[model samples]
Target chain A: MTIDKKLNGTSLVIALEGRLDTMTSPQLEEELKTSLEGITDLTFDFEKLEYISSAGLRVLLYAQKVMNKQGSMKVIHASEPVLDVFDVTGFVDILTIE
Target chain B: MMTLTVKAHISNLSMVQDALGEWLDSIGCPMKTSLQLQMAVEELFVNVASYAYGEEEGDLTLSYEYEEELSLVRITFRDQGMPFNPAECLEQEEESTRLHVEDRGVGGLGILMVYKTADQVHYSYRDGWNILILEKKL
Candidate 1:
């Protein structure tokens, strides 16, 4: 997966492209860990993201836990199929989607 | 019925998906059903690759039979690794009510997705192999 980042003040927006499954989730975890410092708001753009597995959900859950203490987080532009997964996994209730 | 066998590893996930996609397309499976099938397959394949044999390398065979009469598809996964039953996890989650967000974990969600997406899921240990079968209606 390719992650493109845009830093606007204290808010950080990261857009992901490609599949976010077991093979690629670790890359996202590392990116979030290193880039989250001094950031209050985190937004994920999933318009280009085609797939996500449980491994990816784990990373997003961990990120949400961290962001809860810092500020806020939102996931936007999730495709119908990806959103279906979130809905089935009950992540739709836990995460803010816009 | 058709079958495909491959080494259990995270790196081979793409190949597995590609092959399954082609087979499903050839069968003229609906796009929605195909998506669910792919999701269920990925979850089981990743589970076996990550934990079934640990450091040891093994192969997993996936076989499926599509019954046009019933409009149902049955996919079976076989591996010669540890005997781990996924159905028990589903039972435990169902009995445990009032699970809070703090209790929401990512570990069991994959198996849960497999159970939810598939119409039926069964696990058995037979002839030194762990066999998991998932059935979905088209």
Candidate 2:
């Protein structure tokens, strides 16, 4: 997956393209780890993201936890399959989706 | 029925998905069903690769069959790594989903999803091989 970042001051928006599975999630996790410092607003754009596995969800959860303490995080343009996963795993209640 | 065997490594996930996706497509499986099956396969395959052999190298064989009459697909994973039964993880599936974010652990959610999404899942260890079978109705 390709992660495109748009940082405007403290707000950061990440747009993802392609599948986010076991092999790819670590890339996103590492990106978030380095990019989240001092950022108060984080948004994920999933319009181009095709697939997400549990590994992907774990990364989202980690980001959410960090944002919960520092600021806020939300997901946008999530596909139906991704939404279904969130609903089934109960992440729908934890993460803000738009 | 078709079978493919590859090294149990994280990098091989895409290869597995591509091969299986092709098969599913050739069989005229619905897009949603194909996606779910692929997700389940990734979870099981990653579980085996991450924990099954620890630092040692191993291989996994994936076999799949499509029952045209019933519109069902069955996928199986066989490995010689340590014995682990994914089917039994269903017991913790519900509790894991209900836990709050602060209290929620990340490890077991993958297996929980496999159980929840797959129509049927079975596990067995025999002849020094761990066998996991997942069935989904298309």
Candidate 3:
């Protein structure tokens, strides 16, 4: 998957494209590591994200945990397949989605 | 005999997800089937890492073999972290207040998804490992 990052004041928006499987999860994690600092609000645009693996969910969970400390996090426009993955994993309750 | 093994750190989950799909694709499984298999892998691995290992570190071995006649991908997950098989546990239904959200969806969904996706699944604790085997016809 490809990830692009944008900053809106303290809010950080990340747009994801392609698939988030085991191989591409690291790129996302790296992006989060490099970009999350100094950003208090985070929004993930998953409209272009086609597929999600449990590993991807785990990363999301981790990002949520991090955001809990510094700022707020949200996921927007998740694709059907990726949404299904989150639904099955009970992330709907844990995450803030729009 | 063929074997592929990789040592993974539990803290990096997203990378593992990407690796799973690429692995299936490399084995010549169609994209659709690969997606299903990868989903199952994701659920099981995350469950193990989260529930079984907790905050500890352990080894995870993912092995697969293709049975051309059956057109199948037989994959197994072996880990020494804990003795638990999520498939054997019954799922908790969603509950609602008037009938609430809890009764709609709660626990056991992941294992159920794994069951639905795999053509065959089995679980056993043998040789100091929690082993889960799943087969998907390609």
Q: Give lDDT tens digits, candidate 3, residues B73-111.
A: 888888887798665563431221122232332234557
How well does candidate 3 reproduce the true complex, by DockQ? 0.18
After best superposition, candidate 1 residue B23: deviation in angstroms? Answer: 1.3
Number of the top lDDT candidate = 2
Query: What is the TM-score (0 to 1) of candidate 2?
Result: 0.95
* Candidate 1 Cα outliers beyond 4 Å, as residue runs: B92-99, B103-106
Residue B68 lDDT in candidate 2: 89
* Least accurate 10 contiguous residues by lDDT in model 3 chain A: A81-90
DockQ of each: 0.47, 0.76, 0.18
lDDT of 1 at A37: 85
Model 1 Cα lDDT, one tens digit per residue, B1-81: 889899999899988888888888888898777877888899999999999999999999999788989988999999999
Where's the lowest-lDDT run of ten residues in candidate 2 chain B? B86-95
Worst 10 residues of 3 chain B by lDDT: B93-102
Q: Please, what are the lDDT tens digits per residue for candidate 1 over residues A1-98? A: 99999999999999999888877899999999999988899999999998887788889988888898899999999998789888877788779999
Query: Model 1, A77: alpha-carbon shift in Å?
Result: 1.8
**Which candidate model has the greater TM-score, 2 or 3?**
2
User: How much is A41 displaced in model 2, in angstroms?
Assistant: 1.4
> By DockQ thresholds, what CAPRI class is model 2?
medium
**What is the number of residue pairs that collide in model 1?**
0
Instruction: Give the candidate order by descending DockQ.
Output: 2, 1, 3
Question: In DockQ terms, which candidate is top?
Answer: 2
1 or 2: which has the higher lDDT?
A: 2
